[model samples]
Target: MTVRAVRRTSLVEQAVTELRRLVEGGEWPVGSRLPGEVELSRLLGVGRSTSREAVRALIAAGQLHSRQGLGTFVASIAPVTDFDRQLRRAELAHIYEVRVALEVEAGRLAALRRTRADISALRDALAAREQARGAAELVDVDLEFHRAVVTAAHNPVLTDLFATFLDAVRDASTEMVADQGPSPEDHKHDAHAALVQAIEDSDPQAAMAATRHNVEHTLAQLRPERP
Candidate 1:
């Protein structure tokens, strides 16, 4: 409803991707009702059935919500990529692997983009993490600290993607915590501190390396394979 145009595409996937771009890119803000089926099809330069399928796909992906009488509205900007859709089905090992990859980039971005206030928040989160006593407590604090790092990256898309993925990660982490009860991430406090230091110093490479070191510490303990 807020956007100007949707790119013409014949295929349903292309139409869906473009629609997702509109939603994720904030062209169509959350909760905005989409144009009627005919208008949407015209905008997308696709047939009515094709556009309908695309809308349905987005609804299934939880990016759109459809009501009985009211038109379809944007539910979320999440499920932006296939990776997000697959995260729920992914193994813990795979999730950790993705975490290392994404968090490294997040660290690098944070190092380059973080402000004084961001650094202060990160330090506060890490302090809370350091004081955590049990597995659940540690999980809560750990997520907070990592979320602060991602937030410092100054990338809205990455921030949204990470938020979407955190749900799956949290469930798996709870299982892992109960099974092995090893907060291997907590064991690498030095690496965590180094990540903060790197960000404070604006050293992107060092920030990435420290993030890798810390996440991989947990990975090694859980999966035993190097990433």
Candidate 2:
């Protein structure tokens, strides 16, 4: 079989990917100066423009920074890979446990900090979730509603943290939703609705309960034989 030809984008993407791997793997630790563009092009075996673009992408990702007189330098070490890899490998139960701990607090904070705009976004996300007719659509909308709740907390770190592993959450949700098979097109979810209501009412404990209630229902279905 013949291998597909690589495009210019694939070239730059791999270059950036390799750069991130080097940085995250500690080969190129934080504050260390990166090799010059000429050297980087040589190392990555690509054109100078390709390496330049790769560096620009990493700079945008907050992994690297450039100085006027000096070359590029590692800005910060994103410890995203190792932990995220483990998280991806984790079982559904373990992932759900993490989700509950994280989201319960998010819901509590959201209840306290939600603005009117936040509420509108939550309603829209929940509505989309309710209206989802396909499993893929449901998986996306489910996470979208949860993301709206996390956003309502008004915590940048919380929102960034959730966004970091959102794909993992989506993968788990896809499997779980697909496992349960098809849901009725007209059926609506009450647990998430309860969550939205609790947040709307500014009731922190109720929000936490609603968040836990929603997760527990899914976890319960997964462990059907539990007493």
- lDDT for every model? 0.80, 0.77
Tens-digit lDDT track for model 2 on 1-227? 99999666578789988998999999998899999889989999998877876776666455776765567889878733544433433466667777888899999999999999999999999889888765556666788899999999999999988887675565556545534544442145788888999999999999999999876656554442645
Query: After superposition, which runs of candidate 2 have C-alpha atoms over 4 Å from their true positions?
Result: 1-90, 182-187, 223-227
lDDT of the structure predicted as candidate 2:
0.77
Write model 1 residue lDDT over 9-92, tens digit each, in one string. 558779988999999999888989999999999999998877876776676566886765577899898854656544433456
What's the C-alpha lDDT at position 68 in model 2?
55
lDDT of 1: 0.80
Clashes of 1: 0
TM-score of each: 0.58, 0.57
Candidate 2: the clashing residue pairs are none
Q: Using lDDT as the measure, which candidate wins? A: 1
lDDT of 2 at 122: 94
